[model samples]
Target: MSYELKSAGALSGGTCCYAGSRLPVRGPKRDLDSPYIAFLGGTEVFGRFVKTPLSDVSESLLKMPCVNFAGVNAGLDTFASDQALQSVARSSEISVLQLLGAQNISNRYYRVHPRRNDRFLQAQPPLKELFPEVDYTEFHFNKHLLSSLQARSEERFAEVRRHLQEVWITRMQEVITTLEGRVLMLWVRYDLKGSAAFNHEPVLVDRSMVSALLGSTMGLVEVDVATAGIEGDFDGMIMGELDFPAAQHMLGPKEHARIGCALAEKLQGLI
Candidate 1:
């Protein structure tokens, strides 16, 4: 389970574009003037640790230029605020947007950093009033703050969950509407898991929730790669000695290839 440690610099080959983006994106820099496919999502879409991500593999399979606009720990708010990234997505013939965890987004109760959606910026009055004794300022990330809140009182945390889901749907709708081309919703999950519980990421949102959020014109592509075949194969896929603990859970090269093929097949039908 050892991978050739390739830093972001090495994989990107010292060529990254930041023209309309807050962060540097993976690139040889494809021409935006011509036809291309845009891939938008969180860390998985960015293909952290893995040498080849879905965008690169899909580009080879479909014979089209693919732009990777995904940001690590990105949420709907990240896309909603970035006009430059939005323009790139609008210009593409088709855009594949990964279904990121709803928890990373901001809601009426709290706010997240615009660029790094996972970082907890501040708590709104409602959240403060709910847990007046808890010092929210001590927290740095959304997951940690929410986990602590839930531990204090499940009833109060229920309200937080409700607000997050509502905001997630609203922000997602707003983001999807701005895209000009055919947008395909790509749901790439480890597996179909349990209900949304406290102390865990909001990785699984209800299908009905997603269906209601997206417009009728959009397409849905669900890829669950938690099968026995690929579940234990992470040898060369994950980058070793990473600071982030979450990098260990990322999908390997085999899963990325599978997802790429599935995306290619789905795109063929749409195009």
Candidate 2:
């Protein structure tokens, strides 16, 4: 794979909205009246610091409209719970759903902000029951809470992992069911996990977890960015100096190009 940065600068995008939908999506918005593809997921799909997200690149390559309804720090619940968003997704000819981390959604263990799935709201009774010795009130983010739980006790943390994984599978199936179109599930694994397993991108989810959803989806496209050594070491990304730290972990322009081409190829075949 080629590793090259296309361009780097500040992003200037218009906001988008659909009828009866109040979700804030990145734009210059596309005309939904035409046949289009909908890209839905979390931060990467939002293309936080990258200028041309993979959705745009795919649009250019396929000569099709790809609406980006992705939100920053969003999880499965972000779209699964949004009626207006689901309506738009269902209307699309095809929907590309990115694989998100399991920890960001609500479950028997905890509740998260409806739109911002990354923000940990409050721990449920079962979570408190599982970690009775610890206080969940100290947490603000799901990843931080999970990291702490793992550090506290690996054996105990295993139950939480299993729960999140199970919930993710069920949530994905439900979301796919509502998407009412040719759905292609995108799996972007940037790196192999280190000691901090929950801290990884798409945390607490593995290939098998996403693979299981394949039976429900039209297909799956797996991009292993770590193999190219471009996961955290990417460059040519556009962002202000303050956002650089977080952007560093994201895919850069070249990475996005590679990803866009991969996705476009699959989508082209389906069309």
The parts of candidate 2 lying over 4 Å away from their true place are 1-10, 192-195, 226-236
TM-score of each: 0.88, 0.90
Across 29-122, the per-residue lDDT of candidate 1 in tens digits comes to 6678879888988777787666788888898998988788887777778888888888888888888988777777877788899978889999
Instruction: Write down the lDDT of every candidate, Cα atoms only.
Output: 0.74, 0.80
Residue 184, candidate 1: Cα error in Å is 0.3
> For candidate 1, which ten residues in a row score worst on lDDT?
192-201
Clashing residue pairs, backbone N/CA/C < 3 A, model 2: none
Off by over 4 Å in 1: 6-8, 191-204, 226-230, 235-246
